[model samples]
Target: MKLTSVSKSLRKLRIPAVLFRRLAVAALPLLLLLALATGCSLFERGGSSAISHKIDQEEDVISSNGGVISNLDKLDSFMERGSGSQRIVQYTIEGDPIFIETRYEGGRLELSYDTTEDAFGPREVKTYSCDKLVRTEEKHQLKYSLKGCGEDMGDGDLLTVDFDLGRQDKFEFILKYGFNHRNEINTVNQNLVKDMLDGTVIEISDYGLPVEDRQSIYRKLVLSNYLGEKQLSTSCNLKPYQSYDLTVLINSAERHYAWSECDTGRDGKVMTEAAEYIIGLVEAGDSFLQLPAATGSVK
Candidate 1:
């Protein structure tokens, strides 16, 4: 009678156990997918056109960890913007080329390097982005109110001009990224005549050169000097610590809109007579990475 009762109890429990096992098997994939979705929610941006994505948390090892980027969940969107083939700009630190991760989107470029992956030992991880072009009113102590670059450079970082902004003839700029941080008058300067609109007389320079004059001197200073030309050509002057490095044409002549990079030096200091007019940067050779070549397809 005891054996008979135990057998009946065992048979009753078998169905429940089989059902539970089946449920667990079915739920495993769903749980894994949820985890991935959660991981890709970190990147953010103010603009809709730009690829705004993030990686909610910083977890894992240097090579196997996750951090936020402009496009996290929709990495496909980024790949779509570029050719699957990519360019790896490799440069050396003291001797070895520091390995870095890089990406491009919305007409901007960004790179990252983790010291944990470098010979220097585990240092902080970094993410870089291009800064927006800006111009300030001279001598007016113009309260520097500039637009944010739509997205943040993650945490533990800051924003700065990647390339120097210069003025040509008040018009002509040589290479690219040279005209960073230029000062243009309010687009509505004409509307702001002291008597016409309100009490504000934008004192026109003797040659009627306001920001134009500033840019003219900038181009002229760097124009005649050899170092000036070289500084403009080689992206060496960009500082390693500076984030949001971008070039903006201060004048009409510089409208071509071009910027390039070089493999040399460690700091982004460049000697240019332009600052006489302004050219300053130190090349941080620690810039480098490894990837397949770009075939010019917009992904």
Candidate 2:
């Protein structure tokens, strides 16, 4: 073949020198070193072009999985401590004012609202607005949380609207109070029952609350949906002394302790009323006493 023919044939068989040099410049230093050390096919057939193709494939995979290289720092920060704050503005029905202060604490967010009313007052209301943080696929961003009654309130959240028991049927539950004779004085039960005269036995007897009344009381519990207008935490448990048993049954079967509810700050006015009502019934009737079990711990 003529020299011109041979030159053209060689050009077609090999990558141009400029293109090969560009590939070497574009490849990452570590990858270039690896390709060179291994004498791999990376550069055999337009090696730089092969590297570019591999990079494009990787990028496609990342994009499909909702990954963004720019957000690596943000992703690392999520596993670390994160914090934010939100504010709620409320206006009373009479155009009076109230405010809710929210802050992130521990592992969850806390919200507090004032539930007090003034003399001759129709209460005001405030609505909350904030960017709710959420993770979407691979990124975190603020989502607009709903604003209005019965929305955006997490469990343990108390709104002023919950405080009203107007015409609402009372909750029905049974309570038992027993005297603890043990000497352990530092315990919660001991402190709560200290005022009770020694040997005063409290028990539950034949109690009958209409099913509707029972449902109403159960609904008033925080574990139920209505968290009255406000919730206040106080150490109000009534523990029997060590080795003493006090049993409280809700809905006629679910077992509980009076002091357990008080210590946990879960008791409210309705619960207090129910306890008193149960006491009145016990004073008038006789029921079996549930003696302390072998388990010595006060619930």
Candidate 3:
């Protein structure tokens, strides 16, 4: 039963004023100790039903075992003390799974959600820093107030791409592309290119792209509806002579959207277009052109 329900029952008993005062005094320390043992403030924001259901399941198991606990419940309880530095609260908001995790060691709070598009996809993570957290009960619901907190990251402000290309001639290349809110574009390339005199050489390069080019790439991707595209399933046939793999990640306030196609029988037209555009832009640089062509078959 909830603590509030127990308090209501005690009030209805109409005990003598003096006895009730003494009982309250005696219970204060126990309540404080219970709160400390659980490593959670009594006003922490979370769904009571979810917590109650978990407790009920544990109780059922204990009863089935004749009140003997063979399996210890790791969940925070008065008897099973928890680490006070970290706390995690999980609940659903309008059918979407939401997780709010806080770490007191660094005074950081992370809010994440499982988007409807992909339940198992990477969750979007947003972080904040504050000295304390406050919560209030409203209409039987607990609401958290993150006052004096500073946000560290925002939604749709970070974009990243992973592109892999393999040719029929046993040549492969991988590109890691990053774009930050500051309009910075960075690319890291790892390629096994076929050099005319060297046969094949491993070339690793890291450089920043022009901001103007970054804007162009970002616009093209947005226009192509890149974030809205879903990953296509691969076929069970033998590996193709030439194949492409692409994964694009966009971080948002709610969740991270990851669109990936890995070694599918055929490359997705939209994703391929975006990958090619980025490659073309990179190769346009004089230094990049010095490296053997990452695409096309060996002569």
Candidate 4:
């Protein structure tokens, strides 16, 4: 009986020991797995998002208020602190005018017109004259840019005219804006385009446009048809381009155009033709090549 009681007590103690071992074996792996999962979560969320968000936020802040870039030096310093590609564009609106003197009416009639450009100012008078053959009523209405250019800039900003000295001559797409001329903040986009096309060094004014727009202008002007066969010329003889920002459409007239309309409709045909012409010129040029900035600090 004493031996039996001893054996029973041993069995009870053995049951508790086995239960403890079972509990430890099941719980250890779960604890290890939880520890590993916690570490993975922390790694997945480390400073990456904060850093990205901070940069993105700063870019947004600058872009939203790009119009008032009063301090060029401070802007230069900010660029010095960053890595990767950075661009700063600067252009001044000198009140210079653009003049387009061309042969229109199938190169039969000669026309000369002075279109005024001063962005911060307005004009009610525009002058047009046909120096060649004329028979019918002379239409003297100064042409404003028909392109969708009036969105940010106002009307009469860009001038266009179709006159018939005898055979319906047209002087279209004339640019006369320069340091002596002034253009609104908007049409200067085309000036940047042309400069890029001609390989001239225009300190781009990231003053109002984003990087994408600047690059888009580069692509368009670099490969545009409107500028094809068109030389970036200074108005040498008749009158200088004064009181404007930059002159575009200096060679040919721009037809009423819309990009979306062209891929699916009619209006883009003129723009396409112009772009095609410009592209042809690009192929034949010692003119413009993209000057990707020196890979270093902005300063």
Q: Candidate 4's residue-wise lDDT over 1-299, tens digit each?
A: 12243345556666687765675567556655765766433123322211111222122212112122222222234334432222222222553332323233332322233222434434122223232222222243223222222244222322222222233232223222322322122333423223222224343332244433333433343223332332232233323322221224322444222232113222234344444443344323332244343333211
Encode model 3's per-residue lDDT on 127-225: one tens digit a residue: 555544444433222234444555453322111121111111222123332221111113424332222322333343455566566556655554344
lDDT of 1 at 146: 24
TM-score of 2: 0.22
> Where in model 2 is the C-alpha error above 4 Å?
1-145, 148-171, 177-196, 201-220, 223-253, 257-299
Residue range 15-57, candidate 2, lDDT tens digits? 6888755654564465656756776533335212111112221
Evaluate model 3: give its TM-score: 0.29
User: After superposition, which runs of candidate 3 have C-alpha atoms over 4 Å from their true positions?
Assistant: 1-199, 236-240, 249-267, 292-299
lDDT of 3 at 277: 86
Query: For every model shown, what is its TM-score relative to the native structure?
Result: 0.22, 0.22, 0.29, 0.17
Q: Per lDDT, what order, best first?
A: 3, 2, 4, 1
Winner by lDDT:
3
Each model's lDDT comes to 0.31, 0.34, 0.39, 0.31
- Candidate 2 steric clashes: 12
**TM-score order of candidates, best first?**
3, 2, 1, 4
